[model samples]
Target: MHEFQLPDMTCGHCAGVVGQTLHLADPACKFQVDLPARKVTVQSDEDRAVLAEALADAGYPPA
Candidate 1:
Protein backbone atom coordinates (compact mmCIF):
# COMPACT_ATOMS: atom_id res chain seq x y z
CA MET A 1 0.00 0.00 0.00
CA HIS A 2 1.02 3.58 -0.66
CA GLU A 3 0.17 6.35 1.74
CA PHE A 4 0.10 10.09 1.13
CA GLN A 5 -0.63 12.83 3.63
CA LEU A 6 -2.20 15.65 1.68
CA PRO A 7 -2.57 18.69 3.89
CA ASP A 8 -4.66 20.47 1.28
CA MET A 9 -7.18 17.69 1.02
CA THR A 10 -9.62 19.18 3.48
CA CYS A 11 -13.11 18.10 2.38
CA GLY A 12 -15.31 15.68 0.49
CA HIS A 13 -14.76 17.56 -2.78
CA CYS A 14 -11.02 17.32 -2.33
CA ALA A 15 -11.39 13.65 -1.58
CA GLY A 16 -13.35 13.15 -4.81
CA VAL A 17 -10.70 14.91 -6.86
CA VAL A 18 -7.99 12.87 -5.22
CA GLY A 19 -9.92 9.68 -5.97
CA GLN A 20 -10.30 10.73 -9.61
CA THR A 21 -6.61 11.50 -9.82
CA LEU A 22 -5.76 8.08 -8.43
CA HIS A 23 -8.10 6.42 -10.94
CA LEU A 24 -6.46 8.31 -13.77
CA ALA A 25 -3.08 7.22 -12.49
CA ASP A 26 -4.05 3.61 -11.96
CA PRO A 27 -7.53 2.44 -12.73
CA ALA A 28 -7.05 -0.85 -10.90
CA CYS A 29 -5.92 0.82 -7.72
CA LYS A 30 -8.08 0.71 -4.61
CA PHE A 31 -8.02 3.49 -2.08
CA GLN A 32 -9.22 4.89 1.25
CA VAL A 33 -9.45 8.61 1.72
CA ASP A 34 -9.60 10.24 5.17
CA LEU A 35 -10.59 13.85 4.98
CA PRO A 36 -10.14 14.45 8.68
CA ALA A 37 -6.59 13.24 8.65
CA ARG A 38 -5.94 14.54 5.16
CA LYS A 39 -4.52 11.22 4.17
CA VAL A 40 -4.92 8.83 1.27
CA THR A 41 -4.02 5.17 1.39
CA VAL A 42 -3.83 3.21 -1.84
CA GLN A 43 -3.41 -0.40 -2.76
CA SER A 44 -2.00 -0.85 -6.23
CA ASP A 45 0.72 -2.24 -8.44
CA GLU A 46 1.70 1.23 -9.68
CA ASP A 47 4.89 2.97 -8.65
CA ARG A 48 4.67 5.18 -5.56
CA ALA A 49 6.33 8.05 -7.35
CA VAL A 50 3.85 7.88 -10.17
CA LEU A 51 0.95 8.06 -7.73
CA ALA A 52 2.53 10.94 -5.91
CA GLU A 53 3.12 12.81 -9.15
CA ALA A 54 -0.45 12.25 -10.22
CA LEU A 55 -1.79 13.58 -6.91
CA ALA A 56 0.49 16.59 -7.05
CA ASP A 57 -0.57 17.37 -10.59
CA ALA A 58 -4.15 17.27 -9.44
CA GLY A 59 -3.32 20.06 -6.93
CA TYR A 60 -3.16 17.83 -3.86
CA PRO A 61 0.55 17.60 -3.27
CA PRO A 62 1.46 15.19 -0.49
CA ALA A 63 3.41 16.33 2.47
Candidate 2:
Protein backbone atom coordinates (compact mmCIF):
# COMPACT_ATOMS: atom_id res chain seq x y z
CA MET A 1 0.00 0.00 0.00
CA HIS A 2 1.12 3.53 -0.71
CA GLU A 3 0.21 6.37 1.57
CA PHE A 4 0.24 10.07 0.77
CA GLN A 5 -0.35 13.25 2.68
CA LEU A 6 -2.38 15.74 0.59
CA PRO A 7 -2.43 18.88 2.66
CA ASP A 8 -4.40 20.85 0.07
CA MET A 9 -7.21 18.35 -0.16
CA THR A 10 -9.78 20.04 2.01
CA CYS A 11 -13.11 19.29 0.35
CA GLY A 12 -15.23 16.64 -1.31
CA HIS A 13 -14.49 18.03 -4.77
CA CYS A 14 -10.77 17.69 -4.19
CA ALA A 15 -11.15 14.12 -2.99
CA GLY A 16 -13.30 13.24 -5.96
CA VAL A 17 -10.77 14.62 -8.39
CA VAL A 18 -7.94 12.75 -6.73
CA GLY A 19 -9.90 9.51 -6.66
CA GLN A 20 -10.94 9.81 -10.28
CA THR A 21 -7.45 10.72 -11.38
CA LEU A 22 -5.91 7.72 -9.68
CA HIS A 23 -8.58 5.38 -10.96
CA LEU A 24 -8.00 6.54 -14.50
CA ALA A 25 -4.32 5.80 -14.09
CA ASP A 26 -4.93 2.31 -12.64
CA PRO A 27 -8.37 0.85 -12.60
CA ALA A 28 -7.53 -1.86 -10.08
CA CYS A 29 -6.15 0.55 -7.53
CA LYS A 30 -7.86 0.72 -4.16
CA PHE A 31 -7.66 3.71 -1.91
CA GLN A 32 -8.96 5.29 1.25
CA VAL A 33 -9.29 9.02 1.55
CA ASP A 34 -9.36 10.69 4.93
CA LEU A 35 -10.61 14.23 4.52
CA PRO A 36 -10.05 15.44 8.04
CA ALA A 37 -6.61 13.94 8.19
CA ARG A 38 -5.77 15.11 4.67
CA LYS A 39 -4.38 11.72 3.78
CA VAL A 40 -4.79 9.03 1.16
CA THR A 41 -3.84 5.36 1.42
CA VAL A 42 -3.69 3.47 -1.85
CA GLN A 43 -3.16 -0.13 -2.86
CA SER A 44 -2.14 -0.73 -6.44
CA ASP A 45 0.21 -2.52 -8.78
CA GLU A 46 1.62 0.75 -10.13
CA ASP A 47 4.99 2.00 -8.97
CA ARG A 48 5.10 4.60 -6.21
CA ALA A 49 6.80 7.15 -8.40
CA VAL A 50 4.22 6.67 -11.13
CA LEU A 51 1.36 7.12 -8.71
CA ALA A 52 2.97 10.18 -7.19
CA GLU A 53 3.50 11.63 -10.62
CA ALA A 54 -0.11 11.08 -11.56
CA LEU A 55 -1.24 12.81 -8.39
CA ALA A 56 1.13 15.67 -9.04
CA ASP A 57 -0.11 16.00 -12.57
CA ALA A 58 -3.62 16.19 -11.28
CA GLY A 59 -2.58 19.00 -8.92
CA TYR A 60 -2.64 17.04 -5.69
CA PRO A 61 1.03 16.53 -5.05
CA PRO A 62 1.78 14.72 -1.82
CA ALA A 63 3.47 16.52 0.99
Runs in model 1 deviating more than 4 A are: none
Error of 2 at 6 (Å): 0.5
Steric overlap count per candidate: 0, 0
Candidate 2: TM-score?
Answer: 0.96
Candidate 2, position 52, lDDT:
90
Task: Residues 1-61, candidate 1: write the lDDT tens digits.
Answer: 9999999998899999999999999999999998899999999999999999999999999
lDDT by residue for model 2 (1-63), tens? 999999989999999999998898899999999999999999999998999999999999999
Model 2 weakest lDDT span, ten residues long = 48-57
Evaluated against the true structure, the overall lDDT of model 1 is 0.96
Instruction: State the lDDT at 1 in candidate 1.
Output: 100
